[model samples]
Structures are given as structure tokens and as C-alpha cells.
Target chain A: MADTDSSQRVQEILTQATEELKSIKVPNDDQLEYDLGNLLVSNNNTLDETLTRDPEKIDSYLHNLARDSIQALLNRVWELPSERIDSDIYATLPKPTTRLPREKPVPKPRPPTKWEKYAREKGINNRKKDKKVWDDVLKRWVPRFGYRKIAAEKEKNWVKEVPSNADPFEDQFAKAAEMKKENVAKNEFQRLRNIAKNKKIKVPSVGVTGNEYASKNELSMAMHHAKHATASRGKFQPELPNEKKVKGLGKKRKIEFTTGSGQVEKKRNIEVLEKMDKPSLNLDGAIHKEIRDENVAMDLKRKGGKVYGRRSKMGGRHRTKSDHKSLKLGTGFQGKGKGKGKGKGKPKGKPNVGAKKKIGGPKMQGKGRPAGKGKMKGKGKGK
Target chain B: MRPLKNEETVLVFTKLKKYIGSNVRALLERSDGLYCFRLHNGRIYYVKEDIMKFAATLPRDNIVSLGVCFGKITKGGKFLLHITALDFLHPYCQNKIWIKESAEQNFMYGNHVYKSGLSRISENTPKYAGVVVLSSKDIPLGFGVAAKATAECRHADPMDIICFHQADIGEYVRNEEALI
Candidate 1:
């Protein structure tokens, strides 16, 4: 009886020891959610306070935490259905739920050709024909078009019966061949015209406008184009004797100065100055500034706390929720405790006025920086 | 060298289509870069647009060749596919004829493949259809037109011609100057 009682006591001690080991780290039920397919684990619970704050033990604690998460993820993966593939067992992963952004921009749709547009409006449906067609004469299936086509049969005719009024010496086969060539050329010309039309390019002249019928300006343009049409681009063309130079040909007159003395030069200078006086604002610079500011604002929203992790313009003060509110109101520089430690560190080159200086000074400089750095040197005392 | 005129494109494509059939679309539309057909002298070259642009910078007479010379546009307006284009056509050829080992030398010597020489022919190959000639081991030897349909070939006499040889490997040695 004593032996059995001792055995029971030993069993109880062993069970108790195991229980103590299990209780050392309680598994937080809400700690992590696993997507085994993607090998992704999202942790919702905060880091264990004692482990994270303890400087010396932080590294090992974090390592063990990661190991446990991965262990849990692998366990879930093991539960998934597996199949043998090429002598190896593989766990087929599910499609990833995350949607990544496309590397390239979405392709623009092709513009409809004139025929396509017309067909759509008229509700015309195109019916495709078989490539091979029955040839009654040849008594075989022949391609409707292309090499060895049925259309080539006409070119095969050796003998022709001529009319009584027709000349007997005239070659009928040559006429048929010439007619076929003309047809091919006509089709090619039409195809080229359609391509030009679809691409919105100017239709080239088709012998419709000649020197006799064309306007003087049109004739001159044609003449100018013809002169440069030679192999050496008219550079080595032999000049005809007593040939006069065509006006407005070759390079345009480069800023011609009058033969007259001081008066002509003064008039040209005055004209140049007047042209420069016209208000020609660089709108591109303003547009670029606006785009940059929008990007910075987007980054700030995504990061939650900082814009580029730099101190705000209010002299080393971190931007707050109120600062964003004031920024939206165009009073970005006028937040609470506007100028604290720094001595009146107003942005240089831009003075804050009644209401006109509402547009941020940093933005007005094109980049998110104060302009005229000569006056604002040594402004940033290390953080 | 210049871009093929519209009629020339149609002519060249039609000739290429004879061998590749509808698979001609694969040659035209590729993801890598733009490819185009250029007419240099009398020859039609299937070239990449990048190389063609570079070639354009050279004087017209200086460039002897550019890209893969598919064939030449004869003065009579017929586009003849050369043996140089065998590599491109081998994979895409719709009809094929495999010749016997005993006849490989005869084919390479630019002789028409006879009935006894043809070991195998693709089923349903029509007469006069463009076909890639292959060795008994299935390696492309050359290309030609089927002289007899698949059905006709069954009852053809051993002495009869099976495939009319348009181009062969021997042309590389025999007609080397004319090839370019």
C-alpha cells in the first residue's frame, strides 16, 4: 500500500511540473491572425510591456515572439489540403488577397478609324468569309486571295479573240496585265489615304493640284519642296545661269539690321525692350509648386506624424493636429505658440502681412525651402 | 532602306502566310519591341524598328543588308522566301514533310524529294501548299511546296516527285553571292 501511494504522489508531481511550464507564457487568443497562404500574420495586440521596455532582454524577447508567430502560421499551413506533385508533396497556396498597384499605367484605348465609327453608327456587322473558296473552273478549293489565287487565272490566258474593228497587232495580254497593275496601285493609294486619315496627318497631294491650277502661294511651296528633293538635298545642284533667288526660300532672314545708322538701331532696341516689358509669368513654376505641396500633404497623411521628419517652420516645433488645421486655413505659420524658443524666426524673403501672405512662404519658393539662403544660413540648430 | 509600301506589305505577308497560316499574327505583334518589314534595294528584310532607325542614319548605298532577309521582291513582283528564312519558318510552318535518311543528301544537293524519299508527311497537307522539309530526325533541312496532296501521296509512284525543291541548304554554298 505504501508503494502504490508513493507512485501516485510521483505522478501528481510530474503533472504539476508540466502545468507550471505551460503557465509561464499565456497565449493571447487575440494576439495574431494568420494568412498561411501569403505567409502573412497581422498582430493586433500590443507588444508585451515587460519584454519590449526591458533594454537588455528586448532582442531575445522579440526573436521568441516572431518565432511563436511563425510557428502558429506554419501550423495553420499544415492543416491545409496537400497533394503530391512530381514525387513531392506540396501544399497548394490560395490566391493572395492583397492587390498590388500596377507597374505600368493603364493602356489608352485605340482611337476608332473612320470606317469603324461609321459602321458602329450604322449597326453594320462584318461577316467573315472562309479563306479558301470553291473554284468552278479549276474544280478545286483555292485561296480567295494571295498566292496561286483564282484571280490569277486571267493572266494565264494565252490566246484572245479580237473584234473585227480592233487592230490585230495589239497585244491583249499586255493590256490585261497593265489593267491589273493599275488596280493594285489604286488599292495601295486608297490604303495609304485611309492610314493618313486615321492618324490625323495631312493627306499628301495626289496630282490634283498642279502649277497651272494651283494658287501662287501653293505653287511656290511646291517649288520650294521640289528644289530640296535632290539626292544631296539641293546642296550640289548645278545652278542655272542668271537664275534669281526665290524670296522666302532656304533659311528665314535672321534679325536683319537696317543699312541706316543710329536711328534704326535705337528703334530695334526700343521694340525689344517693349517685348520684354510684357507680363510673361512662368506659370509652369507655380504649377510645379502646387503639385509638390499636394504630394507632401499626401505623405504627411500617410505617415501620420511628420512631413519628411523635419522640424516645422515654427522653429523646431513638431507639427500638431492644430498646425494642419491652420495650414488648411492658409495660416500655416500662425499656429498656437507660433514662435517659442527661436527669436522671431519668421520665414525669410516673405513678410507676413494682413491677409495677403496667407499662401505659405515655403510653397511660394517652388521647393519646400526658404528662398535667399544667404540671409537664413545656420538657421537649423541640430535636432 | 525604307518602310515597305502598303502593297509590298500585303505581298510579303501573303507569301509568309502561305507557310505559317494564321500564325502570321504572332510575327507582327510581339511584346519585346516594334518589328517592321523594310525594303532595301530589291530584298525584303524583317527588321526590328530600333535597328532600322540606326541603319537609316547610314547612306542608302552603304548598307548591304539589315535584319533577316526573308526574301527578294523580284522584278516580276513575286516574293520568294529564301533558305536563310528557314529558322524563322521552321517553328511556324503549318505543313511539313519529313524525308528519309537515304534522301537527305539528295535534298541538300537541291534535288526534288521523290515519293520513296518521303518517310512521313503531315496529314491533310494540300497540294502546292508551302511546306517545311525536315530530316528523318525532325530537324529542318529546307522548305518547299508539296507537289502532291496528303491523299494523293498514298498512291503515288516511287519515281514521282513528292515535293518541289524551292530552296535548300546547298544554296548557302552554290548561290552564296545571289542570296544577299
Candidate 2:
């Protein structure tokens, strides 16, 4: 026990000293010699038993220990002989990385080009840079279709308002969405952990409360990432899947919105409703009344151009009474009436009473009209 | 090694004197351009230019790099002495730990000596300090890394490979450990 106690004391001193000394000190020469001298004297002087045993021998042992240790250090470091001098200091020193040449090679001058000779003979300076047209857009121009920019402009109109100073996520709803995204990875991990726990998966939970099993990957992932850290440094980039990946999805959503597709879809939906055997009520006051389908009812509501004698902005809405006309050039609005003559129903497929065969009266007949020229009629010599 | 002229080394030696201490200044004062130092029986040293380059990196105004070790301007030459020079001034190096006769063989073989092989340890040794290792017969082994304070290692089991490796051992002849 006593021997163990003394031994323990020695280990600490050694460890502490080595840790301190491992750091480098670069001054040398005489100081190195002095260290060598002192190192020889002080090596075994640090022990408690040595100091207490024999006072005279303590110094002597220290000197011997220091000398030996210093000797070891010098041998390890400098490779110098105790008393002899080596003439080749360069051999002992780190070799110069590059090879030295015997003589410096002279560079040959390039022969003058025709342009340079001409310039020299003409007494004109050639050093000045030629003018460049690279900056001019007319030169080296490429056309851009600007499809994305046009789409962006239309999209910007749809937003109507954007808060300049406030972040979109500063609002509670957006905040909730952002938080959901931030916690998605963790929640997925936790969900797996919970499932494992319920099924009694044999993993030891290293952190947090409860018997939630931690996998090795999860533990390593946690080690790499600090928990609940915020993206406080710069703009928070959401880990959303790329837009190009989900192309045409927004088009499906926009189908119901009263944008370009609304009128076409409404017409198709009206036809489908008409075909359904169980009739639905026309919310637009029609004679036939039945239980209305929700989509059909919405279509009627949208198509109900005049509601309570005022223009309703449901689908094809008119903000002002003067703007109540359809924008398309193909068709005009018609009133509901039975037309006997030319009013409706393809004009009753009417026959003109005075119409005779238009042959000689400002119309050309085969007798009066000459035949159109034909290339291969064989009137000319065959090739 | 060829002794450099006193005029050529005076300024470098002066600057070096500020860092390692006054004995270096005195050693330089009494210098001749004749003999180089002898280390462990006797071996010729290399990379002595490393010392000059290290001194050159220090600021002319103040010795900023006095205690720091910078690798060579071009790499591949890092030596053990660059580190041990500072340890020469380390206060804890007063004590020495002597490896047992059996362990000395292991230590000389480029292996870390176990704490069990420690024949002698100083009482004043502290935790994680630098130390010189010696053979049981009192020949300096080399530098070694202590696992813990001397007092702690005393109570611990002897089977532990407590002394971490630092320098290679070379006494009678130079070995690969002496290459650095």
C-alpha cells in the first residue's frame, strides 16, 4: 500500500510535466547547451525518496540522470558527436528541396511577327489595345423568350399584396407551416422510436426520458447536430422538394379557380350534370326544379350572370355594368326566343326564293370560262 | 558541423537567447566554429537549418514565436528536439521515472511502457505532466507521456498501458526513432 501510494505520486508528476513540455520552444544554441547541462543535473532530483534518502547522493544522482536524459535528447534531435565536429552541416540539415543548376540557362528571344515588323517599319505603336465591342449588346446578342418572367408577372398579379418589411413566415399560419417542416425529420425519428418502443425493439435509449429506443444512426446523427438549433444566421432555406419535381400539380389546383380554364370546365360539368339521371335543381331559376348537386350548384352560382339585378363577381364577374360583355371574338350573346325566320336555330335552314342557278349572271360557266393551264396536259413536247 | 562565424550568428543567437534562456547566450559567447553537440553516445544531426528557419519566423520586434513550434517552410521535416527544447524549461521535468529492466526492452522497441513496469516514480509528479524515462540501471530511456498523475497511477492497476508514447528510444546506437 505504501509502495503504491509513492508510485501514484510519481505518475502524476510525469504526466503533468510531459503535457506542459510537449508544446514547442524554438530558441537554441547556448540555451540548448545550458539546458543540456541543467538537464544532466536535475533529472533524478525531483523524487521525494531520493531527496530524503541521502542528501549527498541526491545531487549526484540528479546530475547523472540529467546528463543521460540530455544525452538521449541530443542524440534524438541533433545527431551531434560528444566531442567531434562534422564538416557537412548541410547533410545534417534538411536538404534543400530543389536541385541547383550548374549554370543559369539563357532564354532565347522570339522572332518578330509580320505585324510587329510592319509596325516597327511604319513607325507606328503596336502596344495600345484595340477597341472592343464586347460590351455592346448589338454584337454577340442572344434572344431570350422570357417565358418564366411573363409567368412570374402573372403570378405577382395573383398575390395582389406582399408585405415588404415583414417576413411571410412571421405570421402565425406561416410560422406553423415552417415549424412543421423543421420538426418533420425529428418527428419522423421519434415516430420510429415510439413504434420500436411499443414493439419492444431491443435498443437502449441514451438520451431524453422514456423507454424510446435509440438506434446507432440516430445517436450518431444527434451527435453531429445540436438539438433544436435555429437557422438564425441567414435566410432560412426550407427543405422543400423542388418545384420542377411537382410540375403540373398547381394546374390541377387552378382548375376550379375562375382563371383561364373555368368557363370550359363549367360547360363540361353542366353537360355531365345534364346526363345524370337523378336531376338536380337549377339555382338559376329554370322551370325544371330538382335536388341540386353541389358542384352543379356552384357552377350555376358562377354562371348566374345577374344576381338580384346586380352583377355578381362569381366567375365571369363584371366590376362595373359596362364591362359585362364576353371578351372572346367568336360568339355574341343571344336572347331566348323561338325564331321562325332568321333569329335562331340555324335560321330554319332557309331557302332563298329568287335564287336561280348562278351560271351566266356574274358567275362563270364552263362555256364562257377558259380552262386553267395544266403543266402535264401534254400540249407541249414531252420531256 | 562546421562552426558558423560569430558575426553571422550573433543576431540569431541573441534572438534565440531571449527565448530558451541565458545559458544559451553564454554558450554562444564561448563558441568556436569547430565541434557540434554529441547526443546519446554520438550521432551526426541533420535539419539544423530548421532551427535557423524557426528563429527567422519570429518577429524582429518581439519574440512572438518563442514557445511555438512551426513546421518547416516546406513540410516533411518535423523533429522531436523542437518540442523537447521547451520541455527543457518545463518545471515538472525535475522528476524521472525509471522503467523496470524487462520494460526497458519493450520501451527500446518503440512500444509504450506500461505503468506496471514503472520501477521508480517521483512523489511530486502531477497529472498529465511530461517526464524523462530511464532504465532501472539509471540510463535515460527517452521522453514519455504519463497517463495520469503519479499519485493516481500508484492506486490504479499495474496492467494499464499508462505511459503514452512520445519519443523513440536510442542509447548505445541510433535507431529509426532517432531519425526525427
Candidate 3:
């Protein structure tokens, strides 16, 4: 009976323990248990003894234990608050130093001196000497001084340089030669002037005289007589020995003209008719005949007129019946067709006919339809 | 419940285990009420609160194939009331138990509570004890461990077991044993 009580007491104690564990809250028990398990296994401790007295209590006891241990640890950690850091710790950090000193200033360059400017100008002047030398070598020497003074000096030098060995006779001979050349030139000029006078006439310039002389007739007559004698001898006629002999001269022939009335009349010189006391019809008739003959000849030579052998048969004749008839026929054909005579086709009429035909013929037919349809249909209907 | 500390966590699970025995299962419960399972095999595991509040937390959709088993195992002169299978637990919880097989793999004794299995509940009578079994195949690797009845207790209010099995059975199958 005592052993039974002991067993009952133990059971009651276990029940009480389970009730108490249930009252305690277990937070994140699974993870806590895992961590605790790892810790135990690493420390070489058995998990069964630490967890429960029997397997029935294993899961419940482990969960409660894990919860309690984790809670206690968190409470302990929270109890000791994190320490605060000092504010002055930032001051201990190193500070940056100042930049290095500025570099020394570079020196400025100086300007050119006055002597350099003067030397440059002199160098430019020296280069101009070539131009001066070129001018001197050309020998177009304009005197550096005044021209009058230079000329006077040159003349004085010439006078002073005259030599005594230069011969006066040689100078005289040169003057005589020059005078002879001048006399010869004068004579040649006079001879040319005389030849010109014989041809027609001209005055000589040897002496200036107010009076002028005319040619004599005797010289002229002698020249004419000599020319006649030579011409008679050249003819091969026998000359009469110093005697006068008369030879019959050919008689002048006269011409006569017949009037259209069949009356023969003597021909008078046209010039004599003009000098006559009375005006004559014969000369007027002759002039008219000549003018008519020239006109007929020109007409025959005109385009398409009949041509005779040497002279025109129609010369000096008025237009005959046939000629007038031909002229009328030509005038009629002037603006009309010559037909097949010239081997050319009929003459063309006005050019506007073709255009007029097109506009009036089909154009009138096109108006029967509306303007747009008709014009469009015409294009579509074309071959 | 207060937040758990690092020292308290070590003292209850890691240090206290040396004073008691090695069969104890330790865990930490989270503030969001998630249960973390720590087994004797040095593995840490987790169970969501919204899955199975009275048992181990897990997803509601995963409850369709859930199973649980409870039993006893005496080790190191301490009588341990052990939970052998609870398939509805999260993968983290299975890792914490440090079992050779996960809830999705076959049961440890060749018994599956989801299809045809035994009950996981147990009596608190003398010479007989209750065990809370929680497991899942949601975790595919590693292990975890934790203490119970401390602030870090997870999955249940008062943990009842000293040791639990939390393991990714796939990992064991891949590494330790080959398939027949």
C-alpha cells in the first residue's frame, strides 16, 4: 500500500509540473530548441536527460525550456542598456594642412631699343643701292647740278682742247667739197624742173622773181613740122624733090534715108539741125527710130521672150498682134495656174482651209454631246 | 513566455543532460507556437502549430496519411517512456528524433500506423508510462536535439519524454544501408 502511494505522488507531481509549464508562454520555441540542441550536441551532452524524464514529456518540456531560456536571455540583454559614445571623439580625427606657397612670378620681356630701329632703317636704305647703280649704267645722265651750268662747262672744255696739229687746210678743203655738193644738187633740181616744164609746165625755185614768162609759139611750130616730116618719111611714100605736088583727097560720102511714105530724103547731121535757123523733123524721126530699136532689142532678151539668130527680128518694131496676145495670156496666168506647161502642180490656196475644215466638220458633230463627254469620247475613239 | 537566452538554453539542454542521463529529449518552443523536437541522437526537429496541436504540429493536408505509435525503452538505468512513430510531424521533428527511418519510410518495427498500425497513446500507471510520438519525412537530411519543460519546449506544453527519434530515413537509406 505505501509503494502505491509513492507512485501516486509521483504521478501527481508530474501532472502539476505539466500544468505549470502550460501556464508559461513559449515564444519561438522551435528555433530556440534547434539552437539549444545544436549547443548541447556541440558540448557533448545528451539531449534526452536534459529534456524530460519520459519520452511523453519530451516535446512539451523542450518547447517550454526553450521559451524560458530565450526570454531570460532577452531580459538580461535588455536590462543592460547599450553604452553611449563621447561626442568629442570626432575632434581626434586628423586635419588637412594648407597648400604649398605660390610659385615665383615669371619676369616680363623688355621692348626694343632706339638703336635697333635706326639700324633697321639704314639696312633698308642700303638695299636701294642696286636701283641707283642700274640708273647710272643706262647713261641717261641728267646732271646732278643745273643743266645750263653743265652745258657751259662742256663748251669751255671743247674750246680748251683744240689742238695745234689739226690742219686749217684740211678744214678749207672740207668746206670746198661741201659747197661743190650743194652746187651739184641745185643743178640736178633745176634740170628736173625743166623736164617737167616741157611735159606741161612748172616754175623753178632757183631765184624768187615777181615776173613769169610764157612759152614761145616758134618752138612749138618747129616741133610740129619735124614730127610731120618724120611721119611722112615713115609712111614709105616717094618725096617730091623740092617741088609742090597736089594729090587728090578721098571724096566724103553722103547717106540718104527713106520715109515711111516712100519719099527718099538726104540725111542731115543731128548737130547741124540743132544749129539751124529752123527745126527739122528728119533728125527727130531718126532719134525716135534708134530709141524704139533699142527698146525692142531689150524686150526680146527679157525672161521667156523668143531669141533670134544674131539680131532680134522684132528690133525697132512696135508690139505686133501676136506679141500683145502673148503678153495678155502671160498676165492672165500671173495669179492663176499655168497648168502643166511649167511641169509644176496646181497652185496652193489659203493655208487656213485645213484648219477650218477640222474645226467646222467634226466640231459641229462634237457639239451634239456634252463638251466633256464628246472630247473624251473623241480621244477614246481615235485609231 | 519570455525570450530564451543562449546560456539558459545551454544549461537546460546541454549542461543539465550531463547531470541527469543521456536519454532525455530536449527542445525549444518558438514564440509563434511552433514545436521543435530534440532527440537523444543529437538531432533538432520542428513541427508547425497548425498541423496537430494536441500531438505534433504539421500541415493539415499531410494529416491524410498521419500515423502515431507510443512505447517504452529503458536505457542507461533510466526507464524511458518513448514515442516510436508519428508520421504527421514535420521533417524537422523527424530529424530531431534521430531515427534511422523517417515517417514516410517504413516504420521502425515494420509497423505502419497510417495504413494498418498500432495506437501511439500510452497509460501513466506505475510500471507503465505515456509517450508522445511525432515524426515526418518532410526533412530529407541531417539531425537535431533539444530539452523539454524549459522555455525552449516545443510541440507540447509540458514535454513527457526523455528521448525521441528524429531522422530523415531517406538519408539513412542512401548512406548507411543499401536496398535489397
Candidate 4:
């Protein structure tokens, strides 16, 4: 009785949504930003709209609603950036008025195909490479990045000495990774449990252990078989019904395209219709190719070879006890053999099989007759 | 190529029943959807409609077959959303953004939300949620993909691109329905 159900799950989602809505409705500066939906929920506890009788509540609500129109004035900005915005925290919203260009991409110079004999005359030799400049201007000093330079500058004795302290904490990424592993395990367990419940089957213990690779092989084989079966079914599925459906849905469209000469105009889709019937429609005749493979598989099996085939355990969807019926239903495969001894028309005593059951109300017989006098019988019982 | 395994089908069914209402039979309602189910290489694939051929080239087993997405494949693949799922979940989803009547008219003609065309947005629309585009009367005008977080959108002007209109399943769809 205490187990969780669909309704309870829905309730949980509703509660979560309500909590989120509460965040939006947090009464900014004592002004209630209540919409008409909120009014109904607060007063009537339903989505049904009704007239508000309380003048004070109405006044406050109207005032807040008017303030929402201030969002209009908020949109009128003096200076805003044209570039795409990635984020906007409440404390520091990005605005072109105050924003400075953060990065300018440096153009990378490609090496020349051939150095000119008069390169010095062409002013190409005026530029000094970073290595040359470093050796000439700054001796015994390696180039440091922006942050490293700042750190080195701050390491002087003139600065105030701060007390050394340390608080150890795992990186957020590492913490999240650990938590995510647990979450993955929990979710997998839940999925397995659900599958077991649905199929009314018992689940094995949580670990597959050594059977993992074998299971993978089996799963892939099943997938291949299923894929082939789908291809065949789709290729052979009746297209006539869909053609009729198209014609039926376009009765008015046909009328709209009537020629002035009173002759019916063929739709432009005739070419498409022809193309669909062609081998090009079925993935360039992959369906027939798969069918050939299946036939080959059948022949190989008939030759008593223990080779990889469609009927093998790895291939095809794993059929359950119930699905086994679908594999054999009404095909007269085994059902034909059952009725061999008996006549074809009808069975001996089974009334429902043929025209043997007597229809309508039962006939009154001599021994089955009841006594007349319904009014007297009721009065007698009452007395 | 093969029918779905009992374990696989049952697992997917349970998920659909939870995320969608129990009334939707999903795989059970149609024998076609059930019989053609594929559990290939650990991934589940069922074609209700559209381009499901991508299942053949699926990279891994992490997918839950939402349905067949016909268009662009992302870094993850077409974000799985079955038509049945879309239809069943249309109302409850908080990611749908409704536009004004004027914008709705132009939206079907290939113009998305211009300035002064916004009407309403559904609840707690999170970052990168697939959004259903709705007209003023709340009829679906295909779908949109949110490009930014809420805080970004809140600070953005009406002219800014908050969502990228993806598929156009609107009045324009009527002409193609009969042809195919």
C-alpha cells in the first residue's frame, strides 16, 4: 500500500513545478507580481477566473500588473552590445556602455615560400623574431604569461605578510565525478528493477561479471536479426492503403486543380509515385539483398553446418513464451495437424463451434411450468 | 531486423508510461511498432514515422529510441522525440513559447519571432530545452530549440535570438501530407 505509483510521481513533479513558480512569485519589493493565473490560484484554488470582490486586493494586484509594464521601459537601453550574449548574472549584466573588448585575435603570419634576395631592401628584415628580441633586450629572463607575471610582482618583501592557512577540499569536478558514478549505478538498478517488474521475471544479481562480453555478442546478434526483419517487413508492407489514404485526404485539392477545358489534370506527384515503386525506393534494393542472405542462411542450416546464421541464438529478438504464439498464430503450421482426426465442418459436442446452439428465449415445458398469480404471491409474502 | 526482447521492450515501455501518460500504449498499441523493434548493439530503435534509418549507423547503446528524427544529427545525435511522445506530452511541457497572432502568420511563412511578437512562455523553461512553437491560441507551430539560458533571455532584447526555429510542422505541412 505504501509503494510509489504513477500518481505519486506526478504529484512529485507538480510539487517541484510549484516550488519553481514560488521562486518567480517572491514578491519583489513588497509588490506582488501576480498574473491572472495567480489570482485564481490564491483566491479560488482553481484555474477558473472570477471577479474579485475585495477592493484592496484588486487595487494592489492592479498596481503590480501596471508595474510589469515597466518591462517596456527596461527594454529601452542607451547602449547594448551587438554580439551574442552567453550569460547574464543579476549582479553584472553585460552592457556595451560599460563593457570593454576582452580579446583581439592575433593574426598568425605564414612562412614565406621563398625569401627575396633583396629582403633587407624590401624592409622584411626589419622585424625581429621573439627569440632575437628576448636575447637582445631582456637577458636571462623567460617570457611569463599574464597571471604568472602578476604573481611574481606580488612576491616582494614590501608587501604586507599574510598568515599562511590551508583548507583542503576536493575539486568540484572530482566530487561530481564520484557522485555521478553512484547516480549511474542507482539508475541502472532502477531500470533493471522496472524491466523485471514489467516482464514478471526475476532479475539476476547486479553483476554480469565474466559473462559481459558474451552478453554483448548476444545483444549485437539480436540487433542484426531485428534490423534485417524490419527491412523485410517495411519493404513488403502494403502500399495500396497509403495510396488510397492520399487520394481520400486530397478530395478538395483535386477539385481545385480542375482544368479550364474540363479535363482532369494529373498531379505532379505521378513521377514520385512511379519512383517509389522502383528499386531505388528500398535503399537501392537492400531489402532483396537481405532476403538473399536469409535464403543463404537457410540453405547453410539445411546442409547441417554449425555456422553463424539468422536462426542462431545471437541473431533475432529473444522471443518470450507469449511472443512464441505470435510466431505461429493462425498460420496452420501446427494447428492443421490438431484437427486431422475430426471432421472439418464441426466438432462433436462443442456448441459454439458451428450452427448447433438454439437461439432466443427458452420454451416452456410441461414439468418446467410455474404457477400463475404474481399479485397474490406478493400479498401473501407481505402478510 | 528482429523483434524487441521482452526485457528491452518492457524497460522502454516503463519509461514511456512514466514520462508520458499510461493511456498511450506506445509500442503495445500497434503490432507494426512492436514487431519491427530493434535492439541492435545495445541500442533500441523503433520507427513510428520519419527517418529512422540512422539507427543502422548508431554509435552506441546509450540511446532510448524516442522516435525517428529526420533532420540534422548533433554531437549526441538527433535528440530523440517520437511523434507519439510529442503528441502525448504537448500540453504538460513548459518549454513551448507562444507568439502573437501577427508573428504566427509570418512564422509559418518562414519568419520567426520579430520584435513585439512575443506572447507567453511555458514554465521553468530550462537551458537547451527543445521547445514547441505555439501560436497565440496555443496551437503548435512546429518546434524551436532554445539557444540560451533564462537569465540570458531575461536580459536579452526582443530582437535577440533566444531560440533557433528548427522544424516547421505547421500549415506549410498540409501540401506535403498528400504527396507522401
State the DockQ of every prediction: 0.01, 0.01, 0.00, 0.02
lDDT of 4: 0.42
**Residues A116-179, candidate 3, lDDT per residue (tens digit)?**
4577877744333322222243345434455454564454444333247766445544555699
Q: Across residues B1-180, which tens digit of lDDT does each residue of candidate 4 receive? A: 223433334444434333333433333344433213344333444443212343334444544443422222124532333332344445544467778887777667655554356677656666666677787887877665665555566666778766666545553364354211
Ranking, DockQ, top scorer first: 4, 2, 1, 3
What is the full ranking by lDDT, best candidate first?
A: 1, 2, 4, 3
Each candidate structure's TM-score, on Cα atoms with residue i matched to residue i, is 0.34, 0.23, 0.11, 0.22
The C-alpha stretches of model 3 lying farther than 4 A from their native spots are A1-383, B1-12, B15-31, B34-50, B54-180
Candidate 1, residue A323: Cα displacement in angstroms equals 91
* lDDT tens per residue, model 4, A68-161: 4343223322122333211211122242333335455776554332233357557676555453113233343433545344444334322333
Ranking by TM-score: 1, 2, 4, 3
Docking model 4 quality class: incorrect
What lDDT does the true structure give each of the candidates? 0.70, 0.43, 0.34, 0.42
Q: Tell me the number of clashing residue pairs for each predicted model.
A: 0, 42, 95, 8
Tens digits of per-residue lDDT for model 1, A10-99: 999999999766333326624687666567876677888888899989999888777677767766677788975212355767766655
C-alpha displacement of A294 in model 4, angstroms?
60
